[model samples]
Target chain A: MDKPALAAWLGAEITGMALLSGGAIQQNWALDVLAGGQAQRWVLRTDAAATLAVSRSRAEEFHLLRAAHAAGVTVPEPLRLCTDRSVIGAPFFIMRRVDGLAAAHRVVRSETLAGGRQALVAALGRELARIHSIVPPRADLPFLGEPASDPCRRFVAAMRVLLDAGRLPRPMLEWGLRQLEISAPPPAATVLCHNDFRTGNYMATEAGISGILDWEFAAWGDPHEDIGWLCARCWRFGGPGEVGGVGPRAPFVAAYEAASGRRVDPARVAWWEIAAAIRWAVVAIDQAERHISGAEPSLELALTGHIVPELELDVMRAVMARAA
Target chain B: MSWDGHEAPDTRALLEIARTTLMEAVIPALTGDARFKALMVANAMAIARREDGPAAAAVHAAVRELGDVAALCAAIRAGAHDPGSADHDRIAASLRALAEARCRISAPKALG
Candidate 1:
């Protein structure tokens, strides 16, 4: 579709257009518009020409945003969803623009941002707690409810399927299965978990966290799963300290504990951290497959293959450390 | 051996060329592509730069360390120092301790 046509369809003056990023499923843009003679910036997310297999539909993603936002999680509000392919040649959605940075390397390296890292991390923990506090059975979201009985067992089984299909390293797969068998956490209160809770998935301002992004993987699970995922070393971007590379583990856990009135167990957290590494390793291998199959052929996907072994090593090291 | 001794170009050098081509050629032509495709290209370039630079050495060193740990575990299993009865748990624990120490001294550095 032409720019003029899109402008007419959106019913706003397109002042400036900047391409944000592209993935397998969608193209994101920072659309600067003059609406009612007032300048505003909004995010334009549209589907790719070649559809992706794993992406949720635009309507589903919008519904998830509304549900999560109404549950008091910090997420960008949905402005409008356009499913008319005639307008833009694909489905798209518009959301209120969120202000803050998402670059992981910049967050770790900028000395100016260093002081606020701890507070931001603490806020992240508290906000994650709030997200996990949502009662999935009561919510009207699509991907709610636990997966059968014994989520860990089912999770391990799913990983095994990926392992079999992807031909992942036997040692890492074996080690992960062994660890899961030995150190299964007792069941806890279930809630809506932002499965992709990590540093890059959040937008932060000096004041605090502004919004959480990426709800495609959100589901109902043990809340500590989110906590362990946040504190995982792979997501820390090499920053010193455990709390998402911002600071030590104690403060982040203390903040979460204070917010949710639950004790943070180091052993359980370590187990989940190991699980996080294994999960990332599996995803990295899958990304590599996507590149190899020419589904994406992205340098990110190619390089992701290299990180799997490192993650395996981390998983082994974490498990071993805890056993000691 | 010389730095260029290998017959095939090293992984780092190959990734460097790919990264350069992507940044200089591919990115400019990606303007009309969908947003997801453009983001993938950008992320690919970023990852390529990292792989061609510091990440190569980091991964190489890590692999070597893991190899060493495996060798140590084999030795312990073969009755060489007993590693306190030499169970899988004991071997894993010892390796973890070693890795933790290394992480303390040389934490993974960020991509600049």
Candidate 2:
């Protein structure tokens, strides 16, 4: 990672550095440094060799994190951003490291954590509310572009383009998109939608959630999309909890409503849940293509393709269940 | 591998044995990310074995009965099977059946 150059940039002595495993699109390193004789632990996030088409750059993510933090969302404090590629061979951002496990299965079943399940869900609800408070027209987030008049339709259109670009035809996904297209909901209030908000993305400890992570996919869209992405069954990770595989939907929605001062819409969230499934399927295929095309060549990426069938079935089931 | 009956093992036999060894012996001894990678390897092998096996005949017939997937895809995008269309329900049913067939191979546990 060119530790010497990084140490020079930070004006610190590197005590230790190691690559942390996780985040397929971005590589994270546990970076410990001694600056001014004060020790600090930080995580350096940088672009991987290959990344998903939708992922934002490190600088953009740093801005998003700054906006979230300014909005009072619990997130790892984004410390510094380096856009120069020569710093570490890629643009990178370093954030203060927060302690806790972000694993979905363990977080769902955790007993040592204080405040139990409902409290944690409520915390996340408030966190999401705070995030959604960041609307468009911000000079800081100019890269988010103009807010879409109809984010749902735009999403389906974008997915169609991506699907057509894919190697094989996905009739199931096409069918799902067709259903979503016909039932496209009226545009709700535009807010910062955490496009990847789901289980296993946040760190939790005995005290509760330490920080909400993974903001690279943040965009200006219907806030219900974030809610649906959180409550999506596929993100449930085999856990029964409806909210990020941790708690029920009612409490989370209630908490969000109380925090956001916006009425929670069940139907819109349901629609976004279908969108979430299709999005996951498309991204999974893209990730697997990285392996199958010999770009990534990792076992994890190969196994991800196997997840598409389950996603296809989920979309079909949702379509049939909601069919007139 | 060819199935010449000299017991050199065909693809299915090879994957099953290799995955069994990986799961039963190798995975038990590994730890952390290595263990996770090994498990994924085992799962990939299992999926490969399933893919090598016969796919659902009904799925093949469904593809033949409905249009080819590419035609079906274009037909869908063109609103040929939109709601209130004559062939909407039939096409939806066929799509669901095909999705289930895929589930049977890639993730049988996902099938209801």
Pairs of residues at least 3 apart in sequence or in different chains that clash in candidate 2: none
Model 2 chain A: lowest-lDDT 10 consecutive positions: A108-117
- The parts of candidate 1 lying over 4 Å away from their true place are A49-55, A111-115, A145-148, B1-112
For model 1, what is the C-alpha lDDT against the true structure? 0.68
How big is the positional error of residue A149 in model 1, measured in Å on the Cα after superposition?
3.4
lDDT of 1 by residue, B20-66 (tens): 77667766766644544655655555554554565456545654655
Deviation from truth (RMSD, Å), model 1: 7.2
- What tier of docking accuracy does candidate 1 attain? incorrect
Candidate 2, residue A213: the lDDT equals 91
Docking class of 2: high
Q: What's the lDDT for all of these models?
A: 0.68, 0.88
lDDT of 1 by residue, A1-324 (tens): 467878897889999888787655577889999988889889888876655454567776777787778767788888888888888777888888888877776666544452475676677768877786676566466455444456566667677677767643335444655567556777776777778888777777666677888776777777778888888988888777577766667667777888878777776677778788888888778878888889765665675775665675687666556656
